[model samples]
Target: MNKREDISGFYERIHYLAPERIGADKPHINVFERASCIGAVPFSRRDYYKVTLILGTGRLDYANQSIYIDRPALVFSNPLIPYNWNPDSSDQHGWFCIFNQAFIQQREGLLNHLPMFQIDADKVFFPDADSVDEIAAFFKAMMRENTESYVHKDDILRNYLHLIIHHALKMQPARDYDRDLNAAARITNLFLALLNRQFPVDSRQHELQLRSAKDFAKQLSLHTNHLNRMVKEFTGKTTTEHIAARILLEAHDLLLHTDWPISEIGYRLGFQYPGYFNSFYKKHAGTTPNEVRKQAV
Candidate 1:
């Protein structure tokens, strides 16, 4: 898997116009009208969360499922999964806004509680025409306020986002997976959350603490075997497999996006030596880190 595209790269790819900055670093929220933007890029995984309202025909490929959209629909995307949208026609009309996890982290237990944003919940909603107009109005309002000079703009936008989420909640249930909701399921969800929390490796100084199944098991307060059994039972993959996959995904992304040397990338990913990192990457990625960087060039 490619490293998920970050906000700056996403803005650059879509040729964003007059981006409104909430801070000196990456902006927490970005809104755009689908029609005025350039042609849609080929589908790929995104690193941030997105809420999109498409008013035209299209096909949405989300994970292993495929949904065809002949009517207006609301789509929710999170960083934990990969998805892509294919418009059937050239005249696509809609609104989409992308925001990082920090934008929604202001309210405690907010993102985790939202059904639409849940990792295994239903992410796509087809709304009635009236509902489409209502939701589109909200996006339009957000776009307008994004350019305003209000001190409370961020607060106001967060409220709008919450309103949209609530509206979706009332529309229809999106969850299709028969979640266990048992102790095992809860543990698996927590383990995955802890695993995901240590992601994107924002800084070279940011060392990854949980690098192995044993490390995660310790953090989750479970014996290593119990942790592995819970994760494997819930996700159908061993705990180590999940950890290695995520680490390799990050390595690929860093290799392609950053100028960090192979040794540094290896160290940042918790490898003790460059040779060990090279062999690990080759075992999982079928190529050395240097080869991956060279291929990207």
Candidate 2:
């Protein structure tokens, strides 16, 4: 299987941290730390949502972007995004709290106010020392409440979580980036999001969506050349390249994990002819699907 096709690479090469998960009995807060000597785990991309609070010093390298967060920074990861973190050997200290998107979604009015869910990390906040202490207190209280048996614990926790995130936004400095995304950039971001949603291909024998870049551009109401330029500017990769790479990666996964026949797989992926699919796979993947499957075995 192509390394990139695996869930880990697609999501973590860049990742989204989401709202906390609220449990039925009580909303629980999970806190843990990753020390320098302990090393950082290559966190695989999960199908669920998670919100991370990084208080220690570490390096997060996602795709070509690297951000060094040394102070108390709140990071949110949504299931729709893939990401990974590389910890620094020195000054590693922090806590990670996770919860589900649905848990927070329960509060109707509160959902729209969540800056993390808005779009990119441009809206994320880094609280000052005092602000951090207040946020810590809010979490600590929730953790304490979680330990006891109480009614409406999930509701209370969600509300508190909402307040904490909102307060962090108030205390932190405003972002310098243009929150007003341009038409081309907005279209490109939406296109990328659409591409990611239709992933983890079902079979090596298949051609998903017949995987059309032109169709995607049309859906976004933009010319093919303009769409390609926007994607190139933001991701430094052509639209077709992204689509083809995603297809090839998923093909590798299917070959490794599923028992589907090669011909059936190709057809499922939208290929009219198995031989055409085989040639396409071989050209980009450096080997036929059969070879990849056999190697996996």
Candidate 3:
């Protein structure tokens, strides 16, 4: 499994010449307008949410679907999925913003309830030329606001982000399924919520608690068999498979991004022994931890 990229790492890789303070402290919101900086590297899975408004043609790959962008489009990305853009033209022009959930924490139920940010919802929206211009104007305003020395700049920026969400919602089609109305769907959503809450492992001290299907089932108050059935019916994958996949992703990130020893990484990931961790990584990733680290170097 390839390492999942985090927000800070992404900033460093893309803005190599920029000062670290440029990307620091605004854990909730970061915005960019120049396409050259963003398109410098193709991104894999990332551990934050993204909203991109593209003004040119490109190819977008998200999860299992590949979309060819011929017109202006609004795209959304979340931590749960992996996506990348392959621009058909070098004239890529757009504005994009990356944010963590904490950035909009006070906007109760805004992101969690919005279909545009949902894990299983359609993430792409093709807008009319007029709408594209309207959205572009908003981005221009945000860029201008970002340069000002106002005291409440963050508050203003948050409002701008919310406005973009509302504009996209007006253009998006209605969802085909309502997970809120179905028991199985609700359970599956809750299960995924529990799974996502343990991510972006920032420190060796922050160990994962729910390491197995049984552990998650216990947390959700469901039998292990019931949990597995619901997960398979909804996502076409077993509960254990989902847990293992997420664990592997975190392992990859830790190996490449941190200098933690292999034993400490194994312990943090819930392995009792280094040998067990090695076996698990080799079996699934087809390489050892040291090799992954060396290749990253």
Candidate 4:
């Protein structure tokens, strides 16, 4: 798995100070020119959203696909997508906006429903030369507004961001996931993206949020049976089964790799009681968690 990068560390690398309101209730947005960039984007999951206008040529790697872009294009990357950007040219010049989820709230849930923000969505867009100039204008407006102290600057900047998204949507690329089962594929990708968002169990204090198929269904605003049926049709497994397999796989990793107590691991994986986790682990793995740890040691 790729390491996770947050906004603070991202700005630190470029020797710039992040906004004071990051990770807070208030929204935060930053705009930067690629000319000031000093390095390539490593393959990692970012805890923010990034939209870039790539005027310079580059190769992008993500989701097991490698695409080389020799023309001006727009690339949209969300926190769920881990990607590596390799610029083939030394003099890379473009504009990018980085913002957290909170920054784009109150737009009728616009970002979440868009294909460009989806994990499996086609993010690279080849806009015409005129469109590129048009898109560049949005970035220029953002850059100009980002440095100003105007009271409503964020509101205007936020609108500029959406304009870019709307612009790219006019030239949306074709998707090839889920065998072209458009309806099933869209919901499945959204479900899978939501499933992935709750992952890695990074903290003992934060248990799995979507612990069951029903929980996921409620979150996605779909009926439980419908969600399960769609997931099964698309992925060859019921939604609950997929969730269990992922939780079990993470349990295996934690048991083999970490010295955390079984009780703590169980709690982190959403088992309310240690005995419950033991039973589940034994039933799934045909052995206890301790036995797995012992064998690994």
Candidate 5:
């Protein structure tokens, strides 16, 4: 099977709804008892908007990175990005709540008001056992109450969930920084998010819908070289490096798990030719596609 077919077996549910169906209006809370093979199941960003909390004893893979959650920890994603999970072990227990962007962006002051949960996507916030227990209990209660035929339960649940998010944010690390550094980092983050949304296009052979760092900078109304400098200073890498990394990751996935021919894989990833794709992969990955498949086995 091809790359797309390889991921077909994975389970994907967005906000109690699929990703395509999720919007500002829908909100949902779900609890999961992880089976031994939860991560083995592959799915796309089209499945869920974000992962509120991953409450399992096993390890997980997100955004092509591996994270081991020993205790209950928080994880989230922007709507534009796609991610996957690889559970280290089969037995895991935890609960997760999925909400639409409208829920979090309730109003102008809401997001800034709760900095803990929104603390950069690359950061993970861990609370004390007591805090984790409290939050977990809140989710459990809301999950149960949501099923009841009570009036205005949706509104009540939303409030309770918001409270949980705020309470969790309290555990975020305290960062002491000058205003310039903070502002620069925030700006870089916005650009990065915009970049992630246009990637892994459904049709790779065509000229990409979005390309070049300058275009992103233009979209965000920032100077091209200035955006480049800010990202490099903040992330310790050039803007091109980040974009290439994302492309390479998708290329790697197609190479390893999918049976798509080299040309088709290249086209799906925005490469005009199979040879260019191979060279690009070799440059960053230091090996050919076949070598990666060999290592996987």
Candidate 6:
């Protein structure tokens, strides 16, 4: 398992000021200034979503996608892709916020549809100089709201986050993205939503309800072959590939974030035996479950 920096580990690595705030029920949105820590941010998968305001020159390594930012840029990072930030100079200055699905009470799946958060969307956007201060102002407001005594601080923080997202969206003109979904595309979306509903698997007892393409197709009231064909035609990946990828992601998170045994983890993920789980983990993740668990230890 590749090491995924959890919210707590991220704070510890970056020497955050208020790491003590992390908890099961209290995992709220957090704001932070750029730390003077030497070297780059760890190049690994993350368990949460992050948005950063890169105020200076730097290079962002997002998996194989390398983006060099020389201006004030806004970058969106989600859990799927592994990323690392290397400042061009020690004069790094910026603001960033870390949040996750739990923070979005009503819009749990909003991040998936956002342009910036998409895997292929331009990850780095240069805000116009005129709008630079305006973008910074939103972050500053978030910082102020993070420490305020207001009862609706989370709401304020969430709104500020939305402002920054909208600002970035405004910076990038409408591409060929907006269109009415075809039947295949709509089915693909529904299939994806149904698959996502089983994810972020946290408990040993909480086994996945939908495990394979056939299961998903049945749930969606479509023939398995039809579902597979449409998903492949629309998304360039078969329905099984999508299900496997999502399950693989959940396996990564569960193996790292929890202390459950490998056997139990396998059980909850629809693998009845540890051997089956280990083989599947290696086949999809290119690493053994034990290897992944070692990083956490």
What Cα-based lDDT does every candidate model obtain?
Answer: 0.77, 0.59, 0.76, 0.79, 0.59, 0.76
- Sequence-dependent TM-score of model 4: 0.67
- The clash count of every prediction, one per candidate, is 1, 28, 0, 0, 3, 1
The regions of model 1 sitting more than 4 angstroms off are 1-3, 17-27, 173-189, 197-217, 222-297
The C-alpha local distance difference test score for the whole of candidate 1 amounts to: 0.77
Best by TM-score: 4
**Model 6: what TM-score?**
0.66
For 34-152, candidate 5 gives per-residue lDDT tens digits of 33234453544442334455566545554345667776776654433444565665555555554555555544324332333232345355667887788777777777876677867
lDDT of 4 by residue, 148-181 (tens): 9899897898889889988887775453432534
What candidate 5 gets wrong by more than 4 Å, as runs, is 1-41, 52-56, 62-65, 68-73, 77-92, 101-127, 148-172, 176-190, 203-207, 218-222, 233-236, 273-275, 294-297
**Of candidates 3 and 1, the better by lDDT:** 1
Ranking by lDDT: 4, 1, 6, 3, 2, 5
Q: Is candidate 2 or candidate 6 better by lDDT?
A: 6
Residue 166 error, candidate 5, Å = 5.5
TM-score rank, highest first? 4, 6, 5, 1, 3, 2
lDDT of 2 by residue, 49-100 (tens): 4445566767664422457877777776655444567766556555444554
Model 6 over residues 1-297: C-alpha lDDT tens digits?
345567887777776666356753454688877654445786666778889888878788753347888888888887766668888887778788898656754455555667676544677888888777988888888988888878788888888888899888887776544422478767877887687666556444578889888898889999999999998887688888787777776677667657888888889999988999999989998889898889779
Point out the worst 10-residue segment of candidate 6 by lDDT: 173-182
What tens-digit string does per-residue lDDT give for candidate 1 at 194-296? 9878876757786789999999999988999999998888768898988898788778777765788889999999998999999999999887899789955
Cα lDDT, model 3, residue 25 = 36
259-283 per-residue lDDT for model 3 (tens digits): 8888898888889999999999898
Better of 1 and 5 by TM-score: 5
Error of 3 at 84 (Å): 1.4
